[model samples]
Target: MEQLHQQSILFAVGINHKTAPVEIREQIFVHEDEIPALLTELRKTLVEAVVLSTCNRTEIYGVTTRTDLDLDFYKDLLINFKGAETFVSREHFFASVSCAACQQLFQVATSLDSKIVGDTQILGQLRDAYAVAKRHEATGKILNQLHQRAFKIGKQARTETRLHKGAVSISLAAVELAAEIFGSLTGKTVLVIGAGETARMTAECLIQRRVGKILITNRTRSNADELLESLKKSNNFAGETIALNELKNHLNEADIIISSTSSPAPVLEKTDFDRQTNKILLIDIAVPRDIAPEVAECKNVLLKNIDDLHSIVDRNSRRRMADLPLVKRIIMKEMSNFLVWYYSLPLLPTVLQCGAKPDKEIQSEIVRVKEFLLANVSHVHKLAMQNGAENFAGHVEVVNTLVAMKNAALTLRLEIEA
Candidate 1:
């Protein structure tokens, strides 16, 4: 009975934004080129496997003929990739089985469980993840169909909901707010502080809106210059890297200042301004507050904090939430269909036995009918002329019954073959 329980088991394990921070998540991150090796490694332990590594999550999905290895067993596989420097171990690595795992992947592909709900990138990421598994022959029929259906359902969610439509990230929300104030960013000179991921994304957003000029500044001049060069290459950005010391001289030139730096204290203070009094819009996205609180006290300064971006995030989330019911309905429908297919696997031998008996029974009946027809052939032909329509009707009905039986036999054979 213990070995019998191994049949048709599906499970998943790993860490995501909900469970781990960027530091911990990065350790398990698998590059596209690394997937084949990982697939080969996982399949050694589990019969079927797929690895989905994205910016916000890293998960290993598996199917095995062993219920003996629990979720922790799979989670340990991910930890084996790299050392556990920042991981909280059990707190960060969550494991799920069967239907729960299936639901998790579907929700992820649809962007329902993304860091920023309704992010448009998860679908493409999921497709890439599944493609790697398929190319390596890592996934069997069950997982192949599961991922394909996940893609289909993700598309259905997009069509049925407005969730993926608006500014999702803090960077995007800040950009959208800028656009609303300035009408158009085509000729605006935006000042960006720091060269971190958030600041890079924010600058990209500004460039996307056709911001006229972008000025980047950082404590280390070399880092600022390097970041500007990278951004320039990416989008052919017409931007300049300013020396941090020149912040005061150039402060008046910027229409908007968005800062996200890892600083212990406020980078932009009231003292940094005052002398250069131009109407300035400040967006501080740093954790310790990059812009000085007193900067907002300046008559010409309009300030917004990182926390303020929540309003936009909430709005976008609500848009996606409105369609949650429809998305869930499709997921449940697909789940039921797959569940029926999964449950039928255990009855394979019984189905085969039941299927063959019908064929023999039908063949025997066909043989009896053929003998009767052959014996009455001449008598039936003469009666057809003597009795006319009544005799002809009787012969036609017998032949029709024979045809029906043959068709039924053919259909049953086809089903068994399938």
Candidate 2:
């Protein structure tokens, strides 16, 4: 028979913290309900794929024969979803196939190159995304196996390396820095400029710090109100919602400002900061920067970017480094397990058919032989022979068939080029 093989191709089109702001990222975030239809639209041409949309990143992973499908077309589709203004230059984008896709996926899964290093949530999110794609039959042999293996590698990195041990999430670092600047959050007024996941995370962290008051603001008043209502559930938080237009007026009133909006440029500019009367500790977690670095020049206005958090996170990163070996061991073990299943995929049906067909043939032959022996042998000799030769020969035929198939598979594999 002619060889049957499939190649995996991965094409990702989206922006991340490195390429776009939170506003841009959020704009591109694919709603869960929209996935099936989106996949349906893409499936007409893409063959099989997975869509991974989160507050931090929106990526597409697929396997297809149409490797030449215009990336601009997909990028245009994303721009329609995310708004074209959010994208900077096209240079920030990436596209790869086979080994390259495999590498990129491994890095993402490990959180090696995430906005927050070693963020564990991403691994689970990736797994869930894969499951959804698989459930919808949107992933084929290539991506199915590659993604599964990448996921295992991610788990291995976490278990084998101290990369994630005591990881300093951006939110936690912002809270810690807030404490250093303001001494305590008990009497401080905090405003979260966006109501997305990062915004919610910042707000939650502030609430945990026992911040005296919290305010939620978003371009969408309903979103701000939604987040505010959620925060009100906590007994300690007593806060209000401010309209996006009202942000500047209350800027002076906030003791701590954490901005995670999806703006293309600085939302809180130098003009927005009032150096006097307000000691605003601004933690900008958004990419493309929500609060301009120049704003930090204002007296009593302490602003920090993502990289600044790395120093503290780095120390914690070192402590967790001790666990890397164990994590690696786990990942290696899982990878081996996954590979066994993966490699066997192509051979499984053939192997099963080989065994099954032989079993049937042997049974038929045994029945024929039994009838012939019954007719030919003496009645006294027939009983023992029926229990021995017929049964043993049938079982032997089945075993021999399996061994022969396995040997054939092994020989075929050895003959194939590495």
Best by lDDT: 1
* lDDT digits (tens) for residues 202-315 of candidate 2: 887788888888988898999999888876776556889999998898988888888887665677888776545757788887664788778889887888876667566665
Stretches of model 2 off by over 4 angstroms after superposition: 1-45, 53-58, 66-107, 110-115, 124-137, 140-165, 181-186, 263-266, 274-277, 292-300, 343-418
Steric clash pairs (candidate 2):
22-262, 23-262, 159-327, 160-324, 160-325, 160-327, 160-328, 161-324, 162-320, 162-321
lDDT of 1 by residue, 1-418 (tens): 1111125556778888778765566567676677898889888878789899865688988877654556666667667755554554756877666556777888897887876777766787788888889888898877987888899888987886666766266678888777777789898999999887677888989989998899999988888898889888879667898888787789999989998776656788888878766777899866446787788888778888755665666767876777778778887777655544443343223333244553675665445444444444444334322332222233233334434544565578679999
* TM-score (C-alpha) between model 2 and the true structure: 0.64
Model 1: residues with Cα > 4 Å off, grouped in runs: 1-6, 167-204, 214-311, 350-418
Best by TM-score: 2
How displaced is residue 121 in candidate 1, in Å? Answer: 0.6
- Every model's TM-score: 0.58, 0.64
Model 1 TM: 0.58
